[model samples]
Target: MSAKVSAGKQVFAIVKKDVLAELRTKEMVIAMFLFVVLAMVVFSQAFGVILNDLDRVGGGLLWVAFLFMSMLGLNRSFVHEKDEGCLEGLLMSPIDRPLIFFGKMLGNLLFLSIVELFAVPIFFVLFRLEMGASMAGIFLATIFLSNIGIACVGTLLSTISINTKTRDLMLPILFMPVIIPLLIAAVSATGGIMSGEELTEVYGSMRFIAVYDIIFLLVAYALYDYVISE
Candidate 1:
């Protein structure tokens, strides 16, 4: 019990540190938000105003924007730590390494959630999506679940890539392929919500995303120590 408490505190401490740093600089969130806006604009232009099948294509475009913006944020997630050699100092601390992973993952999740909170409404307005309240709730839930999966996997991959020579280039290559399953599940769930399908209809995709979150979270937790050590 004491060990568990200590681990929890360590995780919180790390999360607080990351959050405060981001709050001060606004680097990652600002970059991600602007990138998302740009992506939406370009996609809106490509698809044009008379989106006959927005229910089908809008979900894909939304997740594509999310996926790419997430990659941008994840790429920078560890750069600050690496730049200042803070990561090495943290690793040398007595705290368990997995705690660091959880902390960083939570930090990433929080930043991504904040970006989505603002971006989603803008997306709906720009695309002229008219979702019912229930559909809006479901769409938001899908985004939340999908963000968990991205944060978990991206955190691990960012750590891995941060140590590489071509860190920036390596992250997208390592990240995109791994997140395809998540994108598929998220896109499917978002489409179901947009189409006004019953919740039960989209429950399968939601379950898949939930499972993806659990599985990668565990995988990342198990491997983070190794990645950070290298």
Candidate 2:
């Protein structure tokens, strides 16, 4: 019980530290927001004639924007820690290494969630799409499940990429292939909701996402200590 409490506090502290630092900089969030919105605006103009018909393909476009925006944010998630030597400091601290992984993962998850929370509605509005409240709940669930897989795989891979000279290039190389399965499921589920496809099929896609998140979360948890040490 005591160990659990300590782990919780350590994780919270790391998350708090990252959040406070981000609030001061306001850099990652703003950049991600701009990128997502800019993608939408560009798509809107380019596909103006088909804006009304976008709902059929809206899920694909939405995930494309989010996937890229998330990569942008993930690329920076560790820059401050690595630059300031905060990662080394944490490594030497009493906190467990797996806790460090959880801390970073949660921070990524929080940032991704915050940006998407606002962006999703704006996305719907921008493309003149409407979703019933019932379907909306499932839509959000699909995105959140996919976000978990992203944060899990992304946090783990980003840590590895940060130490490389070609980190900016390296992250995409390492991250994109691993995340493709989740992306497909997310797009399928979200598109189903928007296109009013069968609920059973959408639920199956969400289940696949949930399984993907769990699998990677375990992989990251088991590997983080070794990953961080080098």
Candidate 3:
């Protein structure tokens, strides 16, 4: 019998299912956490004390770490789904497709948010860099918008990668080019904010991130059927 679940309920159920599965396995979260931390530490060592000077390119270093870390997290999230054939079952469900998209996105967002939350605080602690009000707000906005962009597109691209022989390496190759605008906007907005630039300076990048999210999310929703059908 088909269950009579609301759209919201279905989405929540999917999100909860993914979250609990991840929590139990703790694979994606732990992998992402360790990957990000290791990346940050390596960056710090490579850049040395230069990163401590917020006057230079500290913000850039942070974003670079995040950008790579996001890739690791995104790939892992979908890999988990693909590994157990869970995604196939999701497609078999009676729930709406967009619900699946949102559910997957929500699950990814949860992990990405957790990674950023922990990573950013540690970044500040290790780097000892303090951000201004505007920069702090921009930092928050970048994480929010970038996560949306990553989740929206990552879900589709991961599906694409799953069908490929090179599922592991294929994701970054396919996903990075597509998400360039997101990275550019996110990096620029973050850079401006960290440099204590005026809000007016970074607003355009913020707008770009917003528009990119809207456009990609819509396109992904429309194309998801095709992606998953294979």
Candidate 4:
């Protein structure tokens, strides 16, 4: 088979396997959902009376909740594969290593997106915030870009973490420092738009996230083979 065809099959197989595993176990969904709701409930109680400015703070809170919740989900994505010894199978495949990274990142993004779809609306309902049209666009764009960043970096880190005595706990310790910039950029962009800032002001933060996405994605692709091997 041609290299391209072989790689394509491997990527598809990885993606399919991840999707089915997630659907059957619902591990990521359940973990993320429970975490999200708990975060919201805690926030609601913390700011119970001061909820007048909820809209102003809503965007930051939403992304903060997502960032932490996603860590839980991303860690689980790799743990499942590791627990089942599937990562070894993937490493033995003839396809390029970058394809494996891309496939895993894609699957992580899909699961995270689904959980956010439910979480975002629930946030609005609980807080009573009006995300204006322009703000809504920026919010969605941030989610997409941030998810890409998270999944790309998270996929590589999970591989590293899985080999440690601390398997799951190691992921956040490694991932949080790397993702701080991305989270800052995402929160700033979302908050700026939600607060009715002009697009020019918001552009800087959005560009930061875009650049982070590109840089981390490349880093993941380059390091993924080594990760799986080690």
Model 2, span 196-223: residue lDDT tens: 9989999999999999999999999899
Ranked by lDDT, the better of candidates 1 and 2 is 2
Model 3: residues >4 Å from true position, as ranges?
A: 1-4, 49-53, 133-135
User: Please, what is the whole-model Cα lDDT of each candidate in the order they appear?
Assistant: 0.90, 0.92, 0.80, 0.83
Measured by TM-score, how close is model 4 to the native structure? Answer: 0.93
* lDDT per residue as tens, model 4, 117-163: 89888888888767777677778887888889988888888878888
What tens-digit string does per-residue lDDT give for candidate 3 at 29-101?
7888888788878987887867756644766777677767777777776776778898778788787777777
Clashes of 1: 0
The parts of candidate 1 lying over 4 Å away from their true place are 1-5
> Which regions of candidate 2 are displaced past 4 Å?
1-5, 48-50
Task: Using lDDT, give the best candidate's number.
Answer: 2
Candidate 1 TM-score, C-alpha based: 0.95
Clashes of 4: 0
Task: Score candidate 3 by TM-score against the native.
Answer: 0.91
Ranking by lDDT: 2, 1, 4, 3
Worst 10 residues of 1 by lDDT: 1-10
TM-score against truth, every candidate: 0.95, 0.95, 0.91, 0.93
List the candidate 4 regions with Cα displacement exceeding 4 Å.
1-5
- The clash tally of candidate 2 reads 0
- lDDT for predicted candidate 2 compared with the true structure: 0.92
